[model samples]
Target: MVCSEFAGCNEAMQGVIRYNPFSNVGFIEAMDQAMSLTPEDKERRMMLTYEHITKSSMTQWIDGFLTDLKHSFNPGQTSYYLGINFSKKAKHKKVNRLMQVRQGFKKLNIENCSTSLLRSNKCAIIIEIESLPNVKFSRHSVPTADVIETIHGLLIDKRNTIIIVGKQTRETLLNWFGRTHSFNGNELWFAAESGYLYKAGIKENWQKLTELENVSWIPQARKIMEAYVNNIDGAFIEERQSCISFNYKNADQEHGTMFIHDLYNLLDKSLKGTNTEIIYGNGFLEAKASTVRKEKLIELLLSKLTTSSKLDYLFYLGNDSSDEPVYELLKSERAKNMFFESHSNKFICSLEKKPSEADFYLEDVDSVRSILEKFYNNTKKKKKIRSFADLTKITNSIAIESQRLKKGTVNASSIANLNQ
Candidate 1:
């Protein structure tokens, strides 16, 4: 049963194959793979998907969003704020502290220590896909094959590499990479969309969607959105089975706001008492059926991961609000106990000056590449992989370094800001 990309149909049934229509070759390949799966295998996948959808409800999605929204803003201010929430005086204090640390880092002989530190640890890296320089919006509208090859190098390494991204974006990357043909549909595991959907791609399961009754309002909603787009010069409609978006990024703020207000009023009155959800971001207005969230997707991934392997270190890096749920979860005692206690759990930001739950900051995408390259080099040189116990020694040495710096025993070497 090959399923449409979105529609409440994904939520209503279990054990359906999923496909992204944007990639013609990939879509056809997925269909071909589905035909070869055994009936028992299909049943097992279906049961699992059913169990998942039943456990993760629409209400959970709404609650998760509200909770994340609350935590996203600065402590005092209520409106949307993305940068570090420092006051004028606090900013000065922070800058001074950063300067002190920068000096301390420079004084520390880290060049000799870098390889040894990373070589000892078994690392699991959860890097956001869009954070890389090659994938930046301005550089490549879609990821090139070269970018995917770089990512594949990281993935095929000894370390556990997780690329966190939205489902739509992941689909595009997979198409470009020519790796979409998977028998079990476990090719892209860490997407913001439900992992179960990816797993369900083993079989063509569109029949499962047709079994469920259609939402009568979906077509009408599309029509209403099209009408709005037709009237507004810069406003354009993006239609999906699960959502409709009116994008006005090129429009002036005044005109965009007015159109949003008019559309919101119309939708509000027309779709009142229905299950439709309205959400606004940057220069886009969206209405969709609330089914799942990024946090829930990550949570499932974590659970599934435990059955496979144990890691000594975990690093999660992301740049947007969608990444907040996983960040917030890791901040909790439960997630800490489950994943962080025995491991060196570090959350990093790809860029500095961004407000995040990250413990450390990398300057930008270049730093990311540098760090990964360093790690790869270290790993490639090693004759044997180090154990967790051996890894602790490296961490202990870093601790000693910290103490020495605090006691002012180390001389400040020349300040060479290598940024990595």
Candidate 2:
């Protein structure tokens, strides 16, 4: 390659000829030198260039670009993009800055909890079931088949498994599970509508924890939201049994923001003094009964579970702000006095480790499933002999076979005779 002695030009390489592009005479001289090379020299240069090109191909270049991009977004990693090296001190500072940006989304250490669960005789797991905006099949979304099967195993084994969802109705949650796999839902519980509605089991009818009389403003609120969202492209209203949400996830950013503020004000003024409250986050605005709280439902469920027996371990997994209060409740001093043994362990995990009440954070929904599957596998009971006599008989048969082998009753000659 004949090129100017600029940034990427390696002039020392055999296949490369560098010229001062600023000097026309030098550039012409370098071009003439390149053309006058003998056949052998041309072949040698071509071979060297071919080798260099093969070593630094487009794939490698793309990979380097992507790595650099990743480092740019998630700073603090030592980057070696385009042959530029970052100093250790600089990397450390970047790392600290990244930590600050993360705002306490620390990596979850599930090993200890897994070990503790295995040793514990009884455990309960609570999972939030709301998908984050713009995320597909999020941890808070419906459970996958593997996750379903794992939870099934836990439930069949009599582990208390409760699902808490904000927007999904009990019917939708059931359908999500039913599509994946069928299992006994006797021990499983569903807390839907952010705990305003709940069902004890699959066969059980959904019961309201709070009366609908308080949420009489829902119909009017839904009508107002529906009318407001009609003008905004890609914006819609999602109506639940006791909650209505304005979803602007697909709307233009500026329009969504403007609509959210206007919608909040509209609802705030229209629903004044009604038993309803407006809450907005990320990509949506929600209006629900003011009395609906997920943490209270959890406390009620825990009280119910503890009535039968004290829990040995409790695990709570959530992905959004709605679950944050539960995390706080679980970690509170008053929670210590409720249902669990004094030495019982509790774990609060969030899908992302941002600033929150959760002590540990998982990367995504897949991580949540992976850890649960690990726990299920770790706690699975080993197969045992049906009876002691069956064990003894198997042992004696093995011993007798060994004695026969020692006596040469099962020799190669005997086998050959039998074949003959």
- Backbone clashes in candidate 1 total 7
TM-score of each: 0.49, 0.58
Candidate 1, 1: how far from true, in Å? 55
lDDT of 2 by residue, 131-210 (tens): 32224424233445666667666654445455545566777767665323334444567787778887766666777787
Could you tell me which residue pairs clash in candidate 1? 1-204, 1-205, 1-206, 2-204, 2-205, 2-206, 15-46
Model 1 alpha-carbon drift over 4 Å, by segment: 1-122, 127-140, 169-173, 178-196, 199-221, 231-236, 246-273, 276-286, 348-420
**With candidate 1 superimposed using the best TM-score fit, by how many Å does residue 17's alpha carbon deviate from the native?**
48
- What lDDT score belongs to each candidate, Candidate 1 first? 0.51, 0.66
Model 2: runs farther than 4 Å from truth? Answer: 1-105, 131-143, 164-166, 178-186, 231-234, 249-262, 281-283, 381-420
